[model samples]
Target: MGVRGLTTFVKNPSYTHDGSTTLLRPHQLSNTPVVIDGKGLLQWLYFENDVDCKHGGDYREYETICTEFIEALHQRGVKPFILFDGASNPDDSKVDTLLGRCRERIQDSAKIIDGDPESPKLRPPFTTAVFLKVLESKEVGYVFCDFEADSEIVALANIMGCPVIGNDSDFFVFDLTGGYIPLSSLRWKEARQLSIPCEKYSLDHFCQAYSMRREMVPLLAILLGNDYVSRETFDDLYHRVIKRSGNIPNGPNVRIPRTIRFLQSRQNFADGAKRLLKDEARRQGKEECIEKSLQAYHIAPESRYQAYLQQDPSMVDIPDCPLPAAYVDLYRRGAFPADYINLKFRNNRKKLLPNLVEDYIRPSCHLISQRIREAIYGILLHGLHDRAVQETGREGQDIKVFIVTGMPSLPEFGSLPNLERMIDLEEERRKVLVMEVLEVDHGRVQAIRDDLKLPVATTIYWRSKLDLPVTESGHHLMRVILLGIAICYSREDLNMDDVKGNLKEAPRVMNRTAVQAFAEWQSCMYYTMHLNTLVNRPYPTPDATKLYHGTLLHRIYATTRLQRDVNPDWVETDVLRGSPAALALFRHLDGVAQNQ
Candidate 1:
């Protein structure tokens, strides 16, 4: 309940290319800082990237992920600073409760009995030690904070005049005028796809649109409940405030309401939070004084260098390193910011389409479109134009075909002469990537490794965050279409029930999570399908009440209706401007044809 459904309220579909003169595309330009929340990223790598600590038989997988993330930022021409949570501030009243957890962590660290110096557990658990190793190896700079990584991320982003990357919804609260990129928003593979129509956003726009800093984004989050605050207590208080005041707080003049008048003198968040606790206590009719129990909420976005460096002079200095050569080439070549997808809603579908536009659909379509674009163009690159050979040993050349299978699917063809050159999918397994050799090759019974690094069909276990809506259905469906086209297979290749069964074991998916299942069916139908147009950005919900349905549900309805209105089964779409992937393919194909 961090920020409690604020994502729904702020990410309005209407705030778009059609209405606003500009949409935030921060990573598109040069000199923008990327502030990484060490915590947010660790969770993403473990969960979404499907990695875990297992290096040195001591769980060092996070190091690999940090390196990859840094590489991605470097490719966008942004040197990043990582801020890692150190200790909770000693002065925070919440510090007492956290002390117990910290004690347990200390005990946990002491218990690590690793003899190997390289063992990640030997350093410390949950303290950014592993990520530190990766950063040092890469000579990447970072901040080692004394508390609250979220606040640090915000503070650093503001100070650097740059964007942020991590999954936290709290970035919006920090007033990130530069912008923010949710790790979920990234295409993860291709560089050009970074500019997919939407996703990047400036919090300055959010503050302006919402009509208040109110200077209370963190206060709102405190009330909604995080690790320290009880959300249920706040919820009860909010209803009572609504019942008595006969007014919700979103309107103007919420300035120091009388219910919390004890705090009107300061009109600041700390006292407002104290008053909230007192109100809850009053509603409960407890004579027990809550003033002593009042903890100063510590979500405030104050920075290290900016806030205290004048006196402290203790800013952590990291060794500056040369940027990766491949990244330099990519930046010089230039990247495209997604051109706005200006779309007009059909009259009949007006109720269904609230903020449907080009930018909105970028998140869902960007990944799939890039993968499909690569799979199709890899044929031109390797099969038609021999580009793979020319680009051999180049970083980012390895194409992994992500699929899902619990068994050895590729080894069945191992006896074939052409297949002999292929690395065994069964060898050197990793999470989700049961068949991939990863970027670095490992010990295998067969000496033959993925030396050529040709676009191997990198299969991943089928999992999705469908209930989240904005990212679910379209992403799942697009993958199905991708695998289908790359291998020239149809519906027969997939077992719908098996697909459902695999995803059923995954956490965070919805009940009977049918999108991935359904995508299997569509992928068969869309085998040869290519977008005739740029994928229209999907809309988020207009009605905030049903936010759980998310953008996934919205796109499922809109995209299907669109397909029905135009081509019943064709997944191909048309656009005034080509998607980056499509545009790349056009140029590649065109270049080869011209040479011929």
Candidate 2:
């Protein structure tokens, strides 16, 4: 959602910089406070960790990466205030943008399957949940804005008199009192010392370099292209208003400099707005569009999260609805997932994660996790007027919105636990409810650790729903889950001499059958984890960091499938050599599934 090519423009010395321009200053980033864009950091950290996105995500490895990052920041004496974006417009204003991104991810996945060495990465579901868990464990300060976090982030940074750490080009338009530190220029990872060298950009430098007024920055952003205004919308306007514009190149990269030069020539935003509005035939409502786009860069004097961050809830802006007070508190603490809010307000849930499995030939990975999602949606939209959730998965042929009506009809699920009561239910009752939701035998999961129950139950459900055979493909999925259990849950019960950290090996091409089976397993875990969160301590949330490594699991799957005469010795070395107990546990779990 950054301004297209704005990052490149800002970095170019010729466009908005001189040899002595202090737009980007070399600064030390220790012993200071900064407000970080949580969403931007999430995506950056995911790709940086090299987590396998083509398969499911490797949460265990991702957790390690995030933990180390936070720890590094803390060791450098940097107090970070992280801000996250919550539900978008209830009216679905961003659906087209969301769908467009989904289509790109779909094509990227296809390229990877066709042997592209390095394709753009897709994020797996639950990546956010894992990151939040890491933050909570580290005791970092963070909050979720009601909608977009940009304005709130700017407000808080100005209030705290600290720089903002993020890569969004929109930050260039927002006038921060301290400055903005683009993540690309920050050397936070090289935390070998107390002070990390980084580059800080200030609005003052931008204005001085361009010889333009501060008020005209937003106008320039809108004209260049932003999430609100398409660059194409203003192309004709640029042609009509500018004289001798033929010198400017005709490409996306030229938009930034061209817009800046136009704004620089005018006295003010009002002066530029007057000429741009003169062309009535080019586009109707041009005046209104410019005004609306300007609002995207508005920075309020006080952020909505300001009081909440100061531990004062009275001034927080909670929505005027009958949403449970407990849920509102969770939202304030950034403990709640944004999807629940979208379902409550929009009655529409769209999942755009492109699992490599093709949607045109078979049902979406979402369909396999429908039951779990339905239960969560039931808890979220309980007494609201909308009793059904419209779920959108892939783009073509697949139904646009699969309406999931009512709660799951499992035994004792008739009166789904409301938000208030969900968190206070008895441990035994919570276990029973979660077991019912998964359609697993109570006796089987009743003995498992509270944190392990949901994942174990999910594996059982996955196996039963898919009716996977005893072939290597099916067993490979089981082996990965068991290894995860031993690592995260039974640390003392198994040896670890044979297991190495995930190797930095290129992903091997896996057969479609194996790929699809694991995708379904990942979907099951993702939805089940969310459902468990909604229902409160039903099963203690599992340690996601120990649960899966996408590359390691994929490597195991491919090795077994490729070899003609693989043996248990290979399995022991690659999957189970260090954990005889893990293999035994899986056997018992499988035995229970067989008897059931």
Best by TM-score: 2
User: What TM-score does prediction 2 earn?
Assistant: 0.88
Error of 2 at 417 (Å): 4.2
Whole-model lDDT per candidate = 0.36, 0.69
Model 1 superposed RMSD (Cα): 22.0
What TM-score does each of the candidates earn?
A: 0.38, 0.88
Deviation in angstroms for 304 in model 1? Answer: 2.8
lDDT of 1 by residue, 166-276 (tens): 776666556674677776666655546343222677756644543334444455555454444545655566555532542333543232232223222234455555566
Least accurate stretch of 10 residues (summed lDDT) in model 1?
A: 336-345
lDDT (Cα) of model 1: 0.36
